[model samples]
Target: MKLSVVDTERCIGCQSCMFACSRLMGKAGLSRTCIRVRSAGGMERGFVVIVCRACEDPPCAKVCPSGALKAKKGKGVRVDLTKCIGCGNCQDACTIGAIFWDDEADKPMICIHCGYCIKYCPHGVLELAKLEAGHAKR
Candidate 1:
Protein backbone atom coordinates (compact mmCIF):
# COMPACT_ATOMS: atom_id res chain seq x y z
CA MET A 1 0.00 0.00 0.00
CA LYS A 2 1.05 3.55 -0.61
CA LEU A 3 0.11 6.71 1.22
CA SER A 4 -1.25 9.63 -0.78
CA VAL A 5 -2.66 13.02 -0.09
CA VAL A 6 -6.07 13.00 -1.71
CA ASP A 7 -7.53 16.26 -0.53
CA THR A 8 -5.25 19.09 0.33
CA GLU A 9 -8.15 21.49 0.40
CA ARG A 10 -9.61 19.72 3.39
CA CYS A 11 -6.53 20.03 5.51
CA ILE A 12 -6.88 22.32 8.50
CA GLY A 13 -3.21 22.10 9.38
CA CYS A 14 -4.02 20.43 12.67
CA GLN A 15 -0.86 18.30 12.43
CA SER A 16 -2.54 15.28 14.00
CA CYS A 17 -1.08 13.02 11.35
CA MET A 18 2.43 14.23 12.03
CA PHE A 19 2.05 13.63 15.74
CA ALA A 20 0.67 10.13 15.25
CA CYS A 21 3.49 9.18 12.90
CA SER A 22 6.10 10.36 15.36
CA ARG A 23 4.43 8.48 18.21
CA LEU A 24 4.34 5.27 16.21
CA MET A 25 8.10 5.57 15.74
CA GLY A 26 8.41 5.64 19.55
CA LYS A 27 9.01 9.37 19.76
CA ALA A 28 7.04 12.33 21.15
CA GLY A 29 7.48 15.18 18.69
CA LEU A 30 7.68 16.21 15.03
CA SER A 31 11.36 15.24 14.82
CA ARG A 32 10.56 11.63 13.96
CA THR A 33 7.54 12.08 11.71
CA CYS A 34 7.74 10.82 8.16
CA ILE A 35 4.74 13.01 7.29
CA ARG A 36 4.61 16.79 7.58
CA VAL A 37 1.78 19.32 7.55
CA ARG A 38 2.82 22.85 6.90
CA SER A 39 0.86 26.03 6.42
CA ALA A 40 0.70 27.22 2.83
CA GLY A 41 1.70 30.71 3.93
CA GLY A 42 -1.51 31.58 5.72
CA MET A 43 -5.02 30.35 6.74
CA GLU A 44 -6.65 31.35 3.46
CA ARG A 45 -4.41 29.01 1.55
CA GLY A 46 -5.10 25.93 3.72
CA PHE A 47 -2.05 23.66 4.16
CA VAL A 48 0.22 21.24 2.37
CA VAL A 49 0.89 17.67 3.34
CA ILE A 50 4.39 16.61 2.44
CA VAL A 51 4.94 12.87 2.13
CA CYS A 52 6.37 10.20 -0.09
CA ARG A 53 4.38 9.45 -3.26
CA ALA A 54 5.99 5.97 -3.26
CA CYS A 55 7.71 6.16 -6.60
CA GLU A 56 8.25 2.88 -8.41
CA ASP A 57 11.81 3.98 -8.99
CA PRO A 58 12.71 6.31 -6.17
CA PRO A 59 15.51 8.78 -6.82
CA CYS A 60 16.52 8.68 -3.19
CA ALA A 61 17.66 5.06 -3.53
CA LYS A 62 19.56 5.80 -6.71
CA VAL A 63 21.73 8.41 -4.98
CA CYS A 64 22.56 6.39 -1.87
CA PRO A 65 26.28 5.68 -2.12
CA SER A 66 26.17 3.05 0.64
CA GLY A 67 23.25 1.07 -0.84
CA ALA A 68 21.36 1.55 2.38
CA LEU A 69 18.28 2.76 0.53
CA LYS A 70 16.91 -0.15 -1.49
CA ALA A 71 14.01 0.48 -3.84
CA LYS A 72 10.88 -1.55 -3.26
CA LYS A 73 9.05 -2.88 -6.32
CA GLY A 74 6.28 -0.26 -6.26
CA LYS A 75 6.35 1.28 -2.80
CA GLY A 76 9.50 3.32 -2.74
CA VAL A 77 12.69 2.44 -0.73
CA ARG A 78 13.45 0.69 2.49
CA VAL A 79 16.35 1.72 4.67
CA ASP A 80 19.05 -0.61 5.89
CA LEU A 81 20.39 1.38 8.79
CA THR A 82 23.46 -0.80 9.27
CA LYS A 83 24.67 0.17 5.79
CA CYS A 84 23.71 3.84 5.95
CA ILE A 85 26.71 6.20 6.06
CA GLY A 86 24.63 9.32 6.89
CA CYS A 87 25.91 10.98 3.75
CA GLY A 88 22.55 12.79 3.22
CA ASN A 89 22.39 11.80 -0.43
CA CYS A 90 18.98 10.16 -0.10
CA GLN A 91 17.58 13.21 1.63
CA ASP A 92 18.94 15.54 -0.98
CA ALA A 93 17.68 13.39 -3.84
CA CYS A 94 14.08 13.45 -2.68
CA THR A 95 12.49 16.08 -4.89
CA ILE A 96 9.33 16.34 -2.83
CA GLY A 97 11.29 16.73 0.40
CA ALA A 98 9.52 13.72 1.86
CA ILE A 99 12.69 12.35 3.40
CA PHE A 100 13.10 13.82 6.86
CA TRP A 101 16.31 14.11 8.85
CA ASP A 102 16.88 12.70 12.28
CA ASP A 103 19.33 15.30 13.57
CA GLU A 104 20.46 13.18 16.52
CA ALA A 105 20.96 9.93 14.55
CA ASP A 106 22.09 11.75 11.44
CA LYS A 107 19.82 9.51 9.37
CA PRO A 108 16.91 9.92 7.01
CA MET A 109 13.33 9.02 7.90
CA ILE A 110 11.57 7.37 4.98
CA CYS A 111 7.91 6.52 5.18
CA ILE A 112 7.16 2.80 5.20
CA HIS A 113 3.54 3.35 4.01
CA CYS A 114 2.31 1.92 7.27
CA GLY A 115 -0.90 4.02 7.26
CA TYR A 116 -0.56 4.79 10.96
CA CYS A 117 -0.72 8.50 10.25
CA ILE A 118 -3.88 8.17 8.15
CA LYS A 119 -5.91 7.32 11.19
CA TYR A 120 -5.05 10.65 12.73
CA CYS A 121 -5.79 12.87 9.76
CA PRO A 122 -9.11 14.35 10.83
CA HIS A 123 -9.74 15.98 7.46
CA GLY A 124 -9.67 12.79 5.38
CA VAL A 125 -6.80 14.26 3.43
CA LEU A 126 -4.71 11.11 3.39
CA GLU A 127 -5.36 7.63 2.07
CA LEU A 128 -3.64 4.22 1.90
CA ALA A 129 -4.18 3.11 -1.67
CA LYS A 130 -3.47 -0.08 -3.53
CA LEU A 131 -1.60 0.52 -6.73
CA GLU A 132 -3.06 -0.99 -9.90
CA ALA A 133 -0.91 -2.24 -12.75
CA GLY A 134 2.08 0.05 -12.14
CA HIS A 135 -0.16 3.07 -11.65
CA ALA A 136 -1.22 4.92 -8.52
CA LYS A 137 -4.22 7.19 -7.87
CA ARG A 138 -3.10 10.62 -6.74
Candidate 2:
Protein backbone atom coordinates (compact mmCIF):
# COMPACT_ATOMS: atom_id res chain seq x y z
CA MET A 1 0.00 0.00 0.00
CA LYS A 2 0.97 3.61 -0.32
CA LEU A 3 2.80 5.13 2.62
CA SER A 4 0.93 7.79 4.51
CA VAL A 5 2.96 10.56 2.92
CA VAL A 6 3.80 13.49 5.13
CA ASP A 7 3.69 16.97 3.79
CA THR A 8 6.44 18.71 5.68
CA GLU A 9 4.81 22.00 4.88
CA ARG A 10 1.67 21.00 6.66
CA CYS A 11 3.35 19.67 9.76
CA ILE A 12 2.84 21.74 12.90
CA GLY A 13 5.21 19.61 14.97
CA CYS A 14 2.32 18.71 17.27
CA GLN A 15 3.61 15.13 17.57
CA SER A 16 0.06 13.77 17.67
CA CYS A 17 1.11 11.00 15.27
CA MET A 18 3.78 9.82 17.66
CA PHE A 19 1.38 9.70 20.57
CA ALA A 20 -1.23 7.91 18.50
CA CYS A 21 1.19 5.20 17.40
CA SER A 22 2.30 4.43 20.91
CA ARG A 23 -1.28 4.42 22.13
CA LEU A 24 -2.23 1.93 19.43
CA MET A 25 0.14 -0.52 21.01
CA GLY A 26 -1.42 0.25 24.42
CA LYS A 27 1.55 2.34 25.44
CA ALA A 28 1.16 5.66 27.23
CA GLY A 29 3.73 7.90 25.55
CA LEU A 30 6.10 8.78 22.70
CA SER A 31 8.97 6.70 24.02
CA ARG A 32 7.44 3.53 22.58
CA THR A 33 6.20 4.77 19.24
CA CYS A 34 7.55 3.68 15.88
CA ILE A 35 6.79 7.10 14.53
CA ARG A 36 8.50 10.23 15.79
CA VAL A 37 7.71 13.90 15.40
CA ARG A 38 10.29 16.34 16.55
CA SER A 39 11.19 19.93 16.02
CA ALA A 40 13.47 20.84 13.14
CA GLY A 41 15.78 23.58 14.38
CA GLY A 42 13.14 24.75 16.82
CA MET A 43 9.34 24.68 16.26
CA GLU A 44 9.30 27.73 14.01
CA ARG A 45 10.69 25.61 11.20
CA GLY A 46 7.95 23.05 11.99
CA PHE A 47 8.23 19.38 12.83
CA VAL A 48 9.34 16.25 11.09
CA VAL A 49 7.44 12.95 11.15
CA ILE A 50 9.77 10.01 11.01
CA VAL A 51 8.07 6.87 9.66
CA CYS A 52 8.49 4.20 7.06
CA ARG A 53 7.85 4.89 3.40
CA ALA A 54 7.16 1.22 2.57
CA CYS A 55 10.03 1.17 0.16
CA GLU A 56 9.86 -0.98 -2.95
CA ASP A 57 13.27 -2.30 -2.03
CA PRO A 58 13.78 -1.96 1.66
CA PRO A 59 17.39 -1.92 2.72
CA CYS A 60 16.37 -2.60 6.29
CA ALA A 61 15.05 -6.03 5.31
CA LYS A 62 18.20 -6.86 3.40
CA VAL A 63 20.42 -5.95 6.30
CA CYS A 64 18.51 -7.85 8.95
CA PRO A 65 20.74 -10.77 9.91
CA SER A 66 17.84 -12.61 11.53
CA GLY A 67 15.23 -12.04 8.86
CA ALA A 68 13.17 -10.22 11.44
CA LEU A 69 12.01 -7.77 8.79
CA LYS A 70 9.51 -9.00 6.21
CA ALA A 71 7.71 -7.26 3.41
CA LYS A 72 3.96 -7.65 3.34
CA LYS A 73 1.25 -7.16 0.75
CA GLY A 74 -0.58 -3.78 0.91
CA LYS A 75 1.34 -2.91 4.06
CA GLY A 76 5.15 -2.84 4.35
CA VAL A 77 8.04 -4.28 6.26
CA ARG A 78 6.94 -5.63 9.64
CA VAL A 79 9.44 -6.82 12.20
CA ASP A 80 9.19 -10.29 13.64
CA LEU A 81 10.30 -9.73 17.19
CA THR A 82 11.09 -13.37 17.76
CA LYS A 83 13.50 -13.33 14.86
CA CYS A 84 14.93 -9.91 15.61
CA ILE A 85 18.32 -9.65 17.23
CA GLY A 86 18.16 -5.97 18.14
CA CYS A 87 21.11 -5.34 15.87
CA GLY A 88 19.96 -1.85 14.86
CA ASN A 89 20.92 -2.56 11.27
CA CYS A 90 17.45 -1.56 10.13
CA GLN A 91 17.74 1.69 11.99
CA ASP A 92 20.91 2.54 10.13
CA ALA A 93 19.55 1.25 6.84
CA CYS A 94 16.49 3.44 6.87
CA THR A 95 17.15 6.77 5.20
CA ILE A 96 13.98 8.37 6.56
CA GLY A 97 14.67 7.57 10.20
CA ALA A 98 11.47 5.52 10.34
CA ILE A 99 12.83 2.66 12.43
CA PHE A 100 12.82 3.55 16.11
CA TRP A 101 14.51 1.93 19.03
CA ASP A 102 12.69 0.55 22.04
CA ASP A 103 15.56 0.95 24.50
CA GLU A 104 13.68 -1.19 27.01
CA ALA A 105 13.67 -4.14 24.60
CA ASP A 106 16.79 -3.05 22.72
CA LYS A 107 14.95 -3.69 19.45
CA PRO A 108 13.88 -1.59 16.55
CA MET A 109 10.29 -0.39 16.53
CA ILE A 110 8.79 -0.77 13.08
CA CYS A 111 5.68 0.65 11.48
CA ILE A 112 2.89 -1.66 10.34
CA HIS A 113 1.30 0.98 8.09
CA CYS A 114 -2.05 0.68 9.88
CA GLY A 115 -2.96 4.35 9.34
CA TYR A 116 -3.91 4.84 12.97
CA CYS A 117 -1.45 7.69 13.23
CA ILE A 118 -3.21 9.53 10.45
CA LYS A 119 -6.34 9.94 12.53
CA TYR A 120 -4.38 11.81 15.15
CA CYS A 121 -2.67 14.24 12.78
CA PRO A 122 -4.48 17.51 13.35
CA HIS A 123 -2.73 19.32 10.51
CA GLY A 124 -3.76 16.97 7.68
CA VAL A 125 -0.13 16.02 7.04
CA LEU A 126 -0.54 12.30 6.53
CA GLU A 127 -2.67 10.29 4.08
CA LEU A 128 -2.74 6.63 3.11
CA ALA A 129 -2.89 5.54 -0.51
CA LYS A 130 -3.79 2.14 -1.91
CA LEU A 131 -1.08 0.07 -3.51
CA GLU A 132 -1.92 -0.88 -7.06
CA ALA A 133 -1.93 -4.57 -7.96
CA GLY A 134 1.59 -5.85 -8.56
CA HIS A 135 3.08 -2.66 -7.19
CA ALA A 136 5.28 -4.33 -4.61
CA LYS A 137 8.70 -5.20 -5.95
CA ARG A 138 10.33 -6.84 -2.93
Highest TM-score, which number? 1
**Model 1 poorest ten-residue lDDT run:** 129-138
Candidate 1 residue spans exceeding 4 A from truth: none
Q: Backbone collision count in every prediction? A: 0, 1
Tens-place lDDT per residue, model 1, 1-138, is 788889999998889999999999999988899988888898688988899888877899999999899987657689999999999998889998999989999999989998999898887999988876766556
- Tens digits of lDDT, candidate 2, 1-138: 555764877997778888898999889987779878788888888776777777777888989999999977667788899999998998998887888899998998888888898898887888888775655422
Tell me each candidate's TM-score.
Answer: 0.95, 0.88
* Model 1 TM-score relative to the real fold: 0.95
CA lDDT scores, all candidates in order = 0.88, 0.81
